[model samples]
Target chain A: EAGVAQSPRYKIIEKRQSVAFWCNPISGHATLYWYQQILGQGPKLLIQFQNNGVVDDSQLPKDRFSAERLKGVDSTLKIQPAKLEDSAVYLCASSSRTFGYHQETQYFGPGTRLLVL
Target chain B: SQKIEQNSEALNIQEGKTATLTCNYTNYSPAYLQWYRQDPGRGPVFLLLIRENEKEKRKERLKVTFDTTLKQSLFHITASQPADSATYLCALPTGNNRKLIWGLGTSLAVNP
Candidate 1:
């Protein structure tokens, strides 16, 4: 079985430019998540999706960040008008829905490292 | 606000010695705690999980303990090796929500 996959492992852009990262989760996993990991800090949950529908996005910076998991498969996270502080690793993870036997033991992707100048 | 803190500073230890790392939290009671290992330029990999109802869990040479009353978790690596060097992260669910929150992580370096 293949693990979660992410594209454009590293990205560099200007502070005001926009950038997008893509994630293809493990097969059969129903829950997808996007997290921001700043340097020297733990990952912060930006959004979570359950079969293409958002389950939680309370911590996301709604003004400049948005994510979508269409068709309940691959997902994308976008940061517009990126700020200097937006330089961080964007991690994508997936797990079986926490409803039955499968709890939320997330499997993370390699992550996209973004550097804003 | 709920917050989780791991001893983020790197820990250096002899290859044959044991290594212990700590995770502490404030203002929230977690249902369970999890540990993950992250190597340079790679995403975190799950190592262990211990619920509040459980006291300890072990796998191979890795051990994890959770203390709800103390809002902390401890991770131990026995018979450590250079291969064990990496950042260890601890995480817990937020409130009644299912979203997991993470700690900054403790970096460990096992020297030969």
Candidate 2:
């Protein structure tokens, strides 16, 4: 089976510019997640989606970041007015299980490396 | 505040040796702990999961031990190879079991 797919493996943008990353999760996977991983640090959950509804997005920067999983399939994460601190890798993951139960193994994408100058 | 920690220093070992990495946490009671391998520029890949009720879990050459009382976990890679060199991360489920709290991974390098 195909793994999670991400577009534009890398991106470079200037501060205050807007950027968007896309993710296509494993087929039939019901849960999708977006995470930000800074250099030498673990991934931080930005948002999670169960079907088309959001499960959790407490870590997300509502003023500058937004994500959507439309029709419960493809998802996208956008960061507007980017800052230097936002120059981290954005990862997309999926799991076969739904939220609210025990956590399941998550399959991750290659991730999109963003460099904001 | 809840926190998870891993060795910040990289572990270097010779091939054919066993590599053991540690993960410690405080102020949280997780139902399960997970380990993942991440290569440079790539997302983490799940390795193993050990529940709070389980003492240890193994898969092939990889072994994981969880101690809820101590609030720590150890990940072992036996007969290590150069291919096993990567950053190993530990994660625990949040209180709601709906999210995960992650640790800054420990890098391991198996020399030939």
CA shift of A84, model 1, Å:
1.6
Clashing pairs in model 2, backbone N/Cα/C closer than 3 A: none
Residues B1-112 of candidate 1: C-alpha lDDT, one tens digit per residue: 9888888579999998999999999998777888999998999999998988888999999999988888889999999999999999998887555678889999999999
Which DockQ value does candidate 2 get?
0.83
Residue B17 local lDDT, model 1:
92
User: DockQ for each candidate?
Assistant: 0.72, 0.83
Highest TM-score among the candidates is held by which one?
2
The list of candidate 1 runs beyond 4 A from truth reads A98-103
Full-model lDDT for every candidate = 0.90, 0.94
What is candidate 1's DockQ? 0.72
